[model samples]
Target: ELSGQWLAHVIQTMRLTYESLTALEIPNDMLQTIQDLILDLRVRCVMVTLQHTAEEIKRLAEKEDWIVDNEGLTSLPCQFEQCIVRSLQSLKGVLECKPGEASVFQQPKTQEEVCQLSIHIMQIFVHCLEQLSAKPDADVDTAHLSMDVSSPDLFGSIHEDISLTSEQRLLIVLSNCCYLERHTFLNIAEHFEKHNFQGIEKITQVSMASLKELDQRLFENYIELKADPIVGSLEPGIYAGYFDWKDCLPPTGVRNYLKEALVNIIAVHAEVFTISKELVPRVLSKVVEAVSEELSRLMQCVSSFSKNGALQARLEICALRDTVAVHLTSESKSSFKQALEALPQLSSGADKKLLEELLNKFKSSMHLQLTCFQAAAPPMMKT
Candidate 1:
């Protein structure tokens, strides 16, 4: 407590020094410059120091009238709500300030940086939730508490400069709200439900925007990546030389690269996919469709390197399977050979057994392709 007081005094002293520049009869331009620097220092200090989950930050936020919007937040249990809400209200002030065009500090944070900060804030909420959930006798069903946000005394000096727009900060707020913990998330979703609003919908909309940007990047770099790579057969037949088949699949791991971008964008934004009144299926389908479409486009540029088509692929499959059988046959797990031989493949294509000398080349795992004659699979359970 004494240390907290000392910290408060330190902040107050800095404020006094900030205000004292005017008494020095400094030029108005010079005063604004110093004030901007002071505000930056103050904001950085508050954000860093107030990160503790102790009562100090909550007390400070409460005492300074720093909270204002607290309708559904009451769902938070008292033990958990204090620090989370306090942290949220403390951070919210940064989003509230709106300055006229053409002011100062360093350049403002870009949209990506803002989203990253938003994600960090939500991570704190998740931590709080998990902390309470882990307690042996914790009761969460009846837990209800309230939170609010407004500017506080310590943070009063911090305001947006010319660089940040209110609209941009609002986006950050929405992004942060999209990832509330389960109970609070349900409360907020219920609010959204009443208003016909969907957080998942908004998140998907934002995701599509990002996807468009990535698509544009891919389109611009199409010629450079040579979307069309020449493919061929190792068997002595084709004359497509100078073209490497290894480059055929988007430089390796491109599918994962693109999927990872979308996954990262949504990871911090949606806590669970199953907790939706009407948004889960829509969101999942959209995600799968988007990836499938992009990957299909990439796949179009790929063709079989096998010069011999299905005949070649099936022969290779048979050879690979037979090899696994021979290596494991000598081991104590001898029944593995019978199981391996039963695997269905193009039965008419090639001999099931491989030559004894060929066993050395079969050190790798066998690959199997399963087919369903049905166009669509039936549900595992009755609807």
Candidate 2:
């Protein structure tokens, strides 16, 4: 059943993509009405896909019912699912009527109409997820999940039935809401942060830039920027002001867990955005920490095993660990250099000497202890 659903969604997405491409080629004035229709259908398709994807995730979670029962599996995606649903549910009244040959259909009179028409297709795509699995009417509490479909006015009463992915759907809803009431984006961002939805937190962070398009409306919404000290001082330019991806640090100090999650998110953005220098060090530090921790764990596990080939595997693990550790050392060389450079400048000669001694102790440990352990391991096993 799951396989069939997956195939169906994939096929639908392909169909919509093809159709949208076709509309893109048609002359703007000649294809205005038809384009709106195509866009709406595409949105419906995206929603269907989101709903199905959410269902598949839920099915897998259910298959591991024992683990889920003992330690509840997260149902956070469902709330995102509903947000998409409400986005579509709110688009009902806003129809994309293409002006007849003599009609002024190509241009929208108000910003609201422009938003409704532009975002129509994407919203349909996200809302289609409702078909994936039956969802409860009441809310569920799960970490990193939030639903802000409470105010019908928030969506402005359109409730169209287009399909869209949760991401694309959220983008469409955000675009329209930001156009109508820029404050809505700020309010939603605050709400999601308070609730701890990291995914939405990142989304809202990027969407805040949409307000820069509005005149004085941008300053009016600046009140919401007061929440995050890190982002509050962000420069008010297109690239820096609202869409500044650098502000995405997870609020965690524990090195291991924080690094792992934060690094993955950074890697994803790096692939997408060609990340700026401001984002590079913060994310690279996390990546370095995560890789080191994983290597350490693998070596410890390999060290304890006594089975055939275990000795060889331990040696291979040691080599990998050394390689990662070296990479980290090289990346953090500047910090190491700064500390070493400050040693001679200390006012207290005795304190400076003590610091030098501690530095020498670290260098000796790295060479004597770590090198000896690596050498003691068996040779690497040939694959």
Candidate 3:
């Protein structure tokens, strides 16, 4: 059942015992526990962590100087095969049998019996590892290197009486486990530096002298793009009708939507990069100021299409002022009506709340201006 990151964590911490003789199992443990251990070992083998397990064992052996044989094995004080056989005998105490257990050495009769034997084999393997690490010198003779064995491989040659079932085959594979040889390998991972700095690079690339020029260029380009003219739908233009030309513009005569647009542009920039949100307001205020100043220059010109637009605008204003004078003299309300209707309709297309508020303020201001202008007319007419 163990898999993924949790199993990886376990693997990271697990240490394997090398240069040890196989030994006996602990008493009174369940048969299922041994089976589970074998299954776990099989999982490790399939994942090729047995190679890593060998590396860990080799690491431990090098630290202890346990390597002694021509065959790269620990010089055991006692016979390794005898030790394994003894361990298997001890592990059989877990089985609920009568005083003398006889079936431990014999070929297993059933699949269940085979499973029971396999579990005990795994238990013996584990026990031998513990004994080898704990008491390497107790029975092991330092004078002799490797012990004489009929089969040199850990589990020896398997003399199978019959072809094993798939499950039995798996258990057979697990029996030998991963045999650890005592040769040393350079673990470069131990020397690797830790990566604690999130996404930021720990090293800087360019020198201070070079960085200044690059930073200046970047800043200048950003300013140029941001401070470009606020044209298109936001600008006021001369809307021509079939009969007369209406000079339509927002009363405040500034691009009210540009502030929101600039803010959104900043927000998107922050989204696309690892930027501090706290820096956005400062950058935004500067950008808004620069862009607002650039856009304000357009207010001086009346029509976007003409170079003499400002002159024509002056003439129009003069004409309006004269009309105002005449209206004041005659007590007329026509000029006031035209000015009110000439302003853009915010209710139709202005989606932003700021624009709605600006529109309301403009309405109130224009209304007040016209009302005051008309109120003064009766007096001028009397005069």
Candidate 4:
């Protein structure tokens, strides 16, 4: 079944049987019975083909590397797409007879059959995708279980291993889903139209809707995984060394947390761009927006800002703003602006000079990180 040779042979034999049955001058009633049986057989073949496709996709998904990278640094359609295409090709060969080739009974019904098959194929693909990306059930509550604190390193190693594996699986799924939604599925729909398949609109709409919903959910999961840690560092970084926003000295430069956040953000930018340049802008935009909003909330909650503390806060925010300047969406920009407005305005010429110097420093650092990110990207994607 996986080889598809059996399917091709069966289809050819059925075609021959239909032709022979028609040529024999068999009675109309007997002919109808034979035609029905052949049609049933064809339907069974289609079902088997769909089942094989689903199984193939699941098999590929279980592998450590589901995305088949044929060329170094060049994004390719995933193995799942190939599986679907192969199945479609096989079905097309059997279901779509050329002009003057279809049997009398099959002629009038070919378009409708093709349409129904197309929808079924799409449903199978979507079902397989959902299964491939489904998260594992939540772990049983471990709080009640006593911990072996003495084996801290062992426990840490196991946790890290599991986390890394889960992250890689998620990356594979998202990259593949993005490619399918943006490229493969559109091409498939176009092919269906070229074949004059009925129900193309509904098929395309339902499949696209499902893919898009999955894509969005995957994106949100990714953002949470990547951005949460960066956002999580905000409060600690802000209050590092017991630094009080209400009683700090004049700003010297951007704080360590701001620097750390920028570094982490750049790293994520590089990782995502390397994986799929198509995902770079949107993913980075969301991550930056999330971090900015969190920063805004944190600053707003501060009871009061000392004169110097406010100056320091403005400096840090400006540095952050400049660092992610390229990736900022309107929402993130608004968040940053709001956070800045909450700070005491810096009117002193010296304060302005200090802020300028800090901004330049952070911008320089950001430029360096971006340079590294560009270098890491594929040559074709450098633009």
Candidate 5:
């Protein structure tokens, strides 16, 4: 720490001397030496700082407990949050001028330097996270394993390492990223602006863009991880026993497959809401849409369906829609509507009446489950 501070002081002093010599109209040849020295010292300072920051982040990534909760629901910030906090603090310490130093002692180019240094440190932080959470060569294995969604232990089978599952690690990284972007980065920008730093906007934009891109990638991966198994189960659950659609009777209640799928979907909602409720709607919307689209496709592929069979399928879809109505995007809602339309319509007055009664019962049952799911959600504002 002392050496770093000493290096910063030397760079600051050299910069001041360079400016003073230039103001006096010193010969170019004479000023060039001081300018070169300043450049060299600045490079050394940045390197030392970056190397130190990277090492700290790597150590933290290795040593810190990444899991917030064993059951995967908690209001606490992610374990790696300190990695980012420390990096920002380190940057501030290096760039901040001494309190007693004159404003002129601060170089005009300090704002640009801050922006560059900030980007470098953030990049390092992200790289460390990438390394820590990286999965081994299990892509092919997971792809094959995920196919058997009928298995109750599908996720367990795919991730049996006894550590954080890939999806859970992703959530941790994503939660940290969101916190950094929304809170920490904003605070840093504000601090810089308060110091009359120019070009802070550029820093905020570049950093935010990077984090947002990572957020998007993480969100998509999570959707894939959680949604695929649920969608895969839909087929066997809906078309159980190779039962011909023509022989399908009027629905007694939601099918076991639909019930099981909803339970799983609600469990996913609970998990995400536990870790990051702010992301719950966005995450679940995509998951629901994927499931809805698959159900629609399954309905379209049906070789035969009695009116009662169609009614059963429609009831299942409606139950799904009602359960997650708040999270449904316009696309998901349209998919559900289209899936309903794809079902055979009932013509008899008695059939229509029966459908309505069954629909009402299904809605009531689903609404109760929805209530329970919502009740389980953590408060919106973190304490």
Candidate 6:
């Protein structure tokens, strides 16, 4: 007992001495000498302590907050929530608790506990948001908040000279939320659309535009890839002016190119089709909402161009329109049969009678076509 008490007193004395040395505002030369002395003392003490068991070392470590002085990456005091996340990263795939490592996603034993933990984290994020939203020159009271925002803080500071509108700030929030939970962010996006948050719609348009550009570039690369070697090798000069060999090479190139081209084309088209289906309705809605009434009406007219065409022509037109719209519309959405039905009746004459007869005979065909198009049209918001 006496020995243990003596050791504790020695430790405390060394700790205070170190603190006092650190607090001294000495000249650089004296400071370096003091720092070297402190390091030597610490190293000797640590070497002597190695004789202690692992459990003793661990207990000491736990009691001392050994990592509290980690390089000051942030102005804030050390945060418990961030500490938990960092611990998780350190132990990932290396250490496992008997039940499981605690995590934000682990199932809580009690609903109250789960709710409490969730609310705690949410409050932390909200507080961080408040700090970020303060005036550019406002002093951020980091001690008041919890949560990791290092990257966001850096990014926000770089843009401090410029003003961010509410929508832009909302976009930043949404982007961070996506990095956290993609599916949840998408659900929130849909809800924003439902609630008429048109900025969300604008974001959707921008996303679709990016996807479309990527698809186009990919397709061009694919085509050029397919065309290159075949076209190059088939040149007569390259083949030593052997016309027959040139013919053979061209045919071979065509065969290989077609095979690879077909696969690449399909892949590119599938990606574009998927993106178009996702973006068109969202984008189209925003465009229509923002455009002049004349432009909006023009779009509607173009959509209805063949409403008065002959039965076969109308059927083809309806099919095409439905294809574009179906990507945007929901499954429960009514088919756009009204567009077909809205075709004006012909004025009386032999031509009119012939048209009327044709319409009656192909009404079922028109209905089928309209059903197909309606299924296609109303879903996407693409341009």
Task: Judging by lDDT against the true structure, name the best candidate.
Answer: 4
Residue 236 of model 2 has an lDDT of: 26
| TM agreement with the true structure for every prediction | 0.27, 0.22, 0.22, 0.74, 0.71, 0.24
After superposition, the stretches of candidate 2 with alpha carbons farther than 4 Å from their true spots are: 1-78, 89-107, 112-332, 343-383
Model 1 residue 383 CA deviation in Å = 40
lDDT tens per residue, model 6, 336-365: 343334444433475445544544444344
Alpha carbon lDDT of each predicted model: 0.32, 0.33, 0.30, 0.67, 0.66, 0.32
lDDT of 3 by residue, 194-282 (tens): 21111111111111222233334434444444434332322433323321123333333222353334334444333212122222333
Kindly report which residue stretches of model 3 are placed more than 4 angstroms away from their true locations once superposed: 1-209, 225-246, 249-274, 303-383
- For candidate 2, lDDT tens digit of each residue in 224-272? 2211221222122212323222233321112222223333433333321
Distance from true position, residue 183, model 6, in Å?
A: 8.0
Whichever of 1 and 4 has more TM-score, that candidate is: 4
- What candidate 6 gets wrong by more than 4 Å, as runs, is 1-84, 87-115, 123-165, 183-327, 331-336, 339-383
RMSD of each: 21.1, 22.5, 32.6, 9.0, 8.5, 23.8
The runs of at least 3 residues in candidate 5 whose Cα sits more than 4 Å from the true structure, single-residue gaps closed, are 9-51, 67-114, 135-163, 194-198, 363-368, 373-383
lDDT-superior candidate, 2 or 6: 2
TM-score-sorted candidate list, best first: 4, 5, 1, 6, 2, 3
